[model samples]
Target chain A: MTTDSLKYLWQFALLCLLQVLIFNHLNLGGYVNPFPYIYLILILPISIGRIQLLLVGFLLGLTVDVFSDTGGLHAAATTLMAFYRPLYLKAQSPREGYESAAVPHIKTFGFAWFLPYAALMVIIHHTALFYLEVFRFSEFFHTLLKTLLSSTLTLAFIFLAEYLFVSTRRRR
Target chain B: MRNVLLFIYRNHVFFVFLLLEFVCFWLIVRNNNFHRGSVLSSSNRLVGNVYELNNNVTEYFRLKTVNEELALENAALRSLLNESKYISSGRKGEVKDSVARQHYTYIPAKVVNNSTDRRNNYLTINRGILQGVEPEMAVLSSEGIVGIVKDVSKNYASVISVLHQNSSISAKLKDSGYIGSLVWDGRDPQVAQLMDIPNHVELAEGMLIQTSGFSSMFPAGINIGKVKEFHVDEGDNFHSIDVELLTNMSTVSMVYVVDNLMRMEQIELEEQAQTDDD
Candidate 1:
């Protein structure tokens, strides 16, 4: 694999480790458990194949599940997040469209574009995660709180992580 | 064959997503099974180890509060044991022999992970199959009944909390002795809906509600909640009673798993009777 692919793989592992070890334990009053691992999916290069993206999402989620002991709740939710990521990207695209090799980061897309993009992905991921965790529609509104609160928190953390790690330099 | 291949190539991304989702759903369904031996759930060794490690570090902060609660419960239990009137009743032959035979044992567990915000909330406890905790056992806090054990691994177990939509506990009015089913409406965490009580039965606001012991999971007289509001519909025969649950589900740190000793025999006899009728 190229150094760039190797770097992405390392970043993926770091995200999973942070999630299971720290974020999984951060249960704030049993209401908020913000997942920052979606940042890994967010930062993936746009040039990656759709099939590869799905596989990567599955592997990323399964790794998180293996540590947290949540069975496959994360796996299913993250896979759905990956599936919709492309559609969401297309919908939020600029008038001229996105560069093929460009990674969607706060620095690259600006907060105006990246904020809504990350928020939507986080919301979708949380919705799927909470609903599947319950596995029933009877408590649609109750599960909505989990989706909303967690999405908000996850978005906050993702922004913080992006601001701290992602560089402002343009791709060569 | 060529057209089909083209179709597969064209919509391959969607197809891959569908297949991966299916696999994930299968994993979720398979792990939800209580009797599965090969499954690695939250209660399994690896996951248990991580939770335990975290608990060890975090538990120190809550030590004083947990100790105080435990001490209060201990005092209550001690007082109950020391009461001569209860023992005297047994000596006077007032208590039935069968009443003495019925035993409900409790296994104490620490709540490692709990959630009250979800539509269906599940609590993961430190105690599991290794500690004699099995699926279908009743879990409760010091104040009230919590939920039923849904799945158990070696060192951990997950409980289907009473706040869940699918959770229905057999409960009754303590003073009037009118039984009903207690369920959550997914709106308020502090409140649950107690339905199926006939309207004719008189129920004032703030009536005490407790377990009816109709089911094998929870024993009779376990405190569920108290009625906060009730209204009888003009056409319907049942009363819509909103109950304020005694257990603060959000903050519960410790719980007891209730194991009915005679559950197997009771289940077997019930199954046999049903088959005989068929």
Candidate 2:
């Protein structure tokens, strides 16, 4: 248990650093800024408590916010994503259901299962984040285009990260 | 009461989520307001230090362009010196007129962190309150105006960039002297809108736009941009003008923070006049 907590802490710190130092600086085509730090929440143990998940998401977002100078925008978006995570998982679970100690990873769940799950999560998070940052409905379509572009880039990066880190031989 | 408690306990996750969202919303609204010093911003010591460290690594790659920009600005400043130009005046002995009295002082600062793609972009500078930096001071790159200081910490300050949605600067046409409010339209980083110039005023493509100095934040005649295109609406009396900003906000790494020496006196007198009228 101590090792598990320590690993998560390290992951959290690394994600925040990667986001602030690297990803935040990427402004591809002046529209897409891939934010893949929310992958921290995505890879948490499926059975983690909801309240704990929410708090973790909020803290992760706040860490990014502190460095990016975007006050609370990420926090709100990540929290909303966390709130829907369990529902999405339950709705998409197989007939046999997930293992008690299962984690959400491409290697653990296979690419087919992980793709839609990660896409949904990334889309929700990006939509909420972009809209909140813009803070108006007047440019709804423009914001939507930006959100979609960023979400696609973020999804691609998340998958790249998953493939790079999660060993393929460790299938559950 | 027991039933109510059970219901609340059963839905504690939703309630907690709502509470956290509310807190975040409050923070966003507060941060959107100008001049509200908040610790969560990048100007905070921990974040500022991290950005400074990152900048230290990336700055080497940009040193060539930065050096050229500095050299160009130095030449411009050198030309402004009294000794640079041959004065035709035969009887000049250190004229101490009020016009010669310095009304602005500049503090050079390094841009540690900056962004341009975001709708409300901000630049974080290494100089802060320790270096006499304060909120509402004007920031300028060597080429043109950059932003206004929004918050200051001990060793860093965050500037609300001219590209921001809430940013508006009083600007004028250099030739016509028609003043307008310069604002970013949240689309293009290089282009900003100059609003409220009357339709009858003669305008031309590539006309120079400059600071009007109506506000205490900036001095008169600071080059902002040049007119890219302008047209009046079918029934409107004002011409909607597009200005191509002179400063490339994306690559601006060195800046100066302007401290208006007469700002306090001007504001105080204006307030007194208002009170008298009331």
**Which candidate leads the pack in TM-score?**
2
Mark the regions of model 2 whose C-alpha exceeds 4 Å error after superposition.
Answer: B92-99
Model 2 chain B lowest lDDT segment of ten? B92-101
Q: Which ten residues in a row have the lowest lDDT in candidate 1 chain A?
A: A163-172
**C-alpha-based local distance difference test score of model 1:** 0.82
In the range B1-278, model 1's lDDT, one tens digit per residue, is 99999999999999899999998888877766655643555556666666677777778898998898889898878876646334534355464556677578889999886666545667779988779998889998999989988778878887888987678999999998998999987667889999999999998887899999989889999999989999987899999999999988877889999999999988899899999999
Q: Residues A96-167, candidate 1: write the lDDT tens digits.
A: 877867888778767898888888888888888888887778768767877788889889899888878776
Would you list the clashing residue pairs of candidate 2?
Answer: none
Write the residue-wise lDDT of candidate 2 on A73-163 in tens digits. 9999999999999999999888998899899997777889999999999999999999999888999999999999999999999999998
What DockQ do you compute for every candidate structure?
Answer: 0.47, 0.80
Give the B-chain TM-score of model 1: 0.88
lDDT of 2 by residue, B1-278 (tens): 99999999999999999999998999899899897999999999988988899999999999999999999989999999979988687986856565688899999999999999888999999999999999999999888999999999999999999999899999999998988999997888889999999999999999999999999999999999999999999999999999999999999999999999999999899899999999
DockQ class, candidate 2: high
TM-score of every candidate: 0.84, 0.97
